[model samples]
Target: MSKPVLTIFYQFNPWDSSIGGIQTVIRSFIKYAPDEFVVRVVGTGAPGSALGVWKWTEYAGKAIQFMPVIAVGEDNVRKLIPTTIAYGASLMRHNFASDFMHFHRIEPTLASLNWAGDKTLFIHNDIRKQMDRNLGGKAILWQQFPKVYFALEKLLISQFEQVYSCNSESAQHYREAYPELAPRVAFLKNGFDPESFYPDKREEREIKRRELAQELGLPETVRFLLFAGRLHPQKDPVLGIQAIAALADPQVHLLIAGAGELEEQVRREIQALNLGDRVTLLGAVNSDRLAQLYRAASAFLLSSVYEGLPVTVLEALACGTPVVTTDCGETPKLLSPDSGVVCKERTAEAIADALRRVLANPDLYSSEACVRTVQPYSAPSIVQEVYRQMLHRWQYRKAIAISSPYPS
Candidate 1:
């Protein structure tokens, strides 16, 4: 008997040049996907280097039948409509062959929802919450658009056979939106690559600390509080800076990594706040370098106003580094006496208080504890869970084939 086929549709190709937690999740998941399933991936916005006619290639040590859609230019809306049509056509052709299909981000889900097969929708964030947040600040048309969008979102979600939420909060939002479909909405959380992210030996960890200090021309005595993510509004990078300044501790240095439209704004605030000496901006660093910083830093920090579980926080926990984060996604659930701390209020003073407390007792949060808490969230464990769920669903459909199949 041959392995069952599982097709995945994603908004962006992980093979293409990209950054962020979503892309990282796709790449990492593919790397650890079970051999029990034959994998096929359909993605959009592939760079020229990755474009091929259904390329059969190996990436991250996994065999994948790859298909990518080319964009005309930089207009995302212009490219998106066509990408959806193209991928949707492919899904229709592969519908019979594939045992099931899974979608990564929203655009792909919306585009390929017409496929008549066992499919799962992965929800990265609450679209309604985002629209609610933006309506007040956007143009007049946008002010009235979110309410309309909320209705459309509910309708679209009702069409899906399954919806995968990364955290309990998101799951609750979906369950509330369509109580009738509550059982169809499932929780499959995000995690980290345990092999690549682990605590270094105490001496080696200190060496990386000294190395980072020397490379950045900083004093070895200073403690670095690391924050790695796109410098976007939702990330609340400015609030993170304000929180650091509130501490007013000269011995603590803040390291901000990742880049985005808000980079200039963050830079200006750094200058205005006289944080130039205490804050270091690292535009972007590869996974290995990021892991090094994780091991070297005193603690990781993220002040996002909202999120659907962040991969960065998981990476930090895997590196055995404590984190100080706003209460977004599963950060609150993941926190404990030995794991890290959270600022539920999302205020500078609240974050400062939490940071101060974590900094006050360095040894209270042990590296072993940090690693242990995140063990269940490792790549291998998550991969197994996804495989089991998809397989079980596939078998259930087969058993029900004799009866009138459930309507879409």
Candidate 2:
């Protein structure tokens, strides 16, 4: 029998040009998908592409078809509506021959809610919590609009046959919030590519450490506390700097590996706190470099105010690096005493204290233990299971459609 066709829709292409956890997850899904299904992806195109134009390309070594909708607006809060309209129009006009439809984020989900097929929704985070934290300081309209939109989404989400969240806790919260739609919501942990992110040998670690020191123009003796994520309000990059300053330990340098809207603010704060030497903004780094940093660092840090299952945390653990994160999303569940530290508070003092403890007794958190904790989140196994479940559900729906006198 032929494999079933599955079409995935998202705001951004799952290629080198794009950078986000959802894009990574989508790439993993396609890369490790089982032989039972054929996957094709639809995403928004680059700005140069004309509106309503469709572009075809190959990415990530997948022979599977990649489609891009030429939507003009960029991915952000202000342009979400315009982008949604353009994307939805493109989706409506395009002819998709897939047996199943998958959506990665809210924009795509909203655009395709009425499309014909058994649909799946992948929730990357607790949208409500993220909005509250991201827009907490913004105007009343900025805060209130998302609330109304999400309220409507509560009704629209029921349209999806299966809804999965990266965080189990977030899944449970969603179920509790919409008991009528609880059966559709479940948790699927985020995963990392083991080949790209794994524990380094003793000698390998030493080599990478020296290389990293040379690349950053830092001394070999410096202990790196790595923070890898977008420099946004949600990520709270400022807190990482504050925590490092609070430590007041010159030897403990913080290496931030991503860039975003708050990059200028983060740099200003670093200089203002006189942490120019202690804090280094490496800007946006590739996965290979990030994995090397993970293997070389004393510990990984995440100071996000809220999150789902952060892919960075998984990648860090996969590289056998101990994580020091705030109590957000499903991080507490992922962290154990022997593996990492979950800060009790989100303040600079709390993060500094946790970092101090982890750095002081580095042996307490063994690399093996850290690697073991994240073994269950390997991309191949997790992606295989997702394929199996999605196929089963799709087959069941096909059976029902064939049996029923009415059209599905």
Q: In candidate 1, what are the lDDT values of residues 258-281, reduced to their tens digit?
A: 876577889999898899999998
Per residue, candidate 2 scores C-alpha lDDT tens digits across 244-312 of 999999888899988766778898999999999998888777788888889999899999887889999
Instruction: Name the candidate that leads on lDDT.
Output: 2
lDDT of each: 0.75, 0.80
The TM-score between candidate 1 and the true structure equals 0.86
- Model 2 scores a C-alpha lDDT of 0.80
What clash pairs does model 2 have?
none
